[model samples]
Target: MSTFLNLLVYGLADGAILALAALGFVLIYKATSVINFAQGEFLLVGAYMFYTAFVVLGLPLVAAVLVGVVVATLIGVLVERFILRPMIGEDPISIIMVTIGLSMLLKALVQMFYGTSPKSQPAILPRSSVEFLGATVPLNRLLVILIAAVVLTAFTIFFRRSRHGIAMRAVADDQQAAMTMGISVRRIFALAWVLAAVSALIAGVLLADISAVDQNLAGFGLMVFPVVILGGLDSVPGTIVGGLIIGLLTQFVSGYQDPGLATVVPYVVLVLILLVRPYGLFGETRIERV
Candidate 1:
């Protein structure tokens, strides 16, 4: 039916953003084994930066994107070097606590500067509607979907072909072995954070284009945990799968049933995944011969 098709298109479009956001979480977890609860704040930072650049300074969109990325990457690197680095040997709980603290601190800072009020983003991309298979759709949404696909493909190739990407894989597999092979584990950790931050920037910009830019944009990162878990925390490409699955499921349910179901579906799926397949669909399985 046309209605089903409409929901499907919208779902796929939204999934693209989910995949982008979850990729950041996966990158940090895969490389450094550190869970970054502050990842959402990075999105907050990106959205604000884009707002300042595009709306306030009236810079060109491309220039604004570059500015957001640079600033976000710098913040990520700083967090790794100054905050996370000092707790390298600390227990996992301590690290998690630190991340929580960092998130709160970042949120407070963002509030102080940007305030709690939501700001509608300027339409950087062209504003137009197009018909797709009997469904009316926004051109911006289509562009976002295309951009997400391109970015995902490019990163997949980078991970498979690039030296640093290979190095990251090596570290993720075995830190000791990677170091033995002359790979700097510390450097790779920093790179993971940088990549994570950059991913957040892209997600933030795309999301702002779709919705209002606000502090609540930070919550988008929470939606990513389910995607990461469902796709496999260590699997890079699985992000797309998980993102699509969740995005489609939420949209489909909300479209067919009650709108309230949309927000609850991801969490329900998350719990089920935790109960049934905690390792996730594409997550690597390891066995220890005792």
Candidate 2:
């Protein structure tokens, strides 16, 4: 029972980060109909930036984090404005190729400056472990869960009440119609990219807090696909639920079975979900008449 509880605790925290990263993917897809392959690179850049500011520049933790987020957001804006914006209306495959190239470029840039070694992030959260629900867990892990929950709730409220959020929903529903309604589709695209960067930065910082900062950190971005696919790519709530499901499965597999299974489980789940429901759990289904 203790072991089970421990797995659950770890799983929930991991899922929260997954959901946060996946949120970035869903937001841009909903707004611009593009899947950013560079999303993970955004995480890498943010984490490294935070490391530099806090450790190298000796900035306060809060200021360092904020600066990292701003730089990440700027990267997103520039990418959207310069690279992706011009490619508007291009084929999905072409856009995908460009993003793949961008991810590689970003990775090379990080390596050039940060080198190929891992760096331990200066402790930003409490290092002490606390017992919870029969299991000992790091305080920082609990903090990650609380922060993710708060952010998710805030996102829900924003979508429901904020004017910009409504406009985003409108654009997602029908870009042409939203433009007709004067939503400024282009501006919404930029805003979506910025918000996506914010999500990536938050996830990156939290993950860095848990582990060390390195190239491997970006690997979490690939995990986002399973979460988004299971939850429904365009459904924010689905993303949260999907993250939990994937997180639990991963923890359970690693705990009881083989550790390697944890890495493979998400893709297996993705295939199963796709086979049963191609549109995902919350994603809308489209029908075409011939």
lDDT of each: 0.87, 0.89
Q: Which tens-of-lDDT digit does each residue in 1-290 have in candidate 2?
A: 87887788789999999898888889999888998898888888878888999888989988997888889879888988999999998999999999999989999999999898998666788989897776787788789999989988888888899999999999988888998988999899999999888888888888888888999878988898999999998889889999989988999999999899899999999999999987799996665688
The TM-score that candidate 2 achieves is 0.96
Local lDDT at 240 for model 1: 92
Among all candidates shown, the one with the greatest lDDT: 2
Residues 25-49 of candidate 1: C-alpha lDDT, one tens digit per residue: 8998898788888878888888898
Clashing residue pairs, candidate 2? none
lDDT at position 115, candidate 1: 90
- Worst 10-residue lDDT window, candidate 1: 120-129
Structure candidate 1, residue pairs in collision: none
* Candidate 1, residue 152: lDDT: 86
Q: What is candidate 1's TM-score against the reference? A: 0.96
Query: TM-scores of the models, in the given order?
Result: 0.96, 0.96
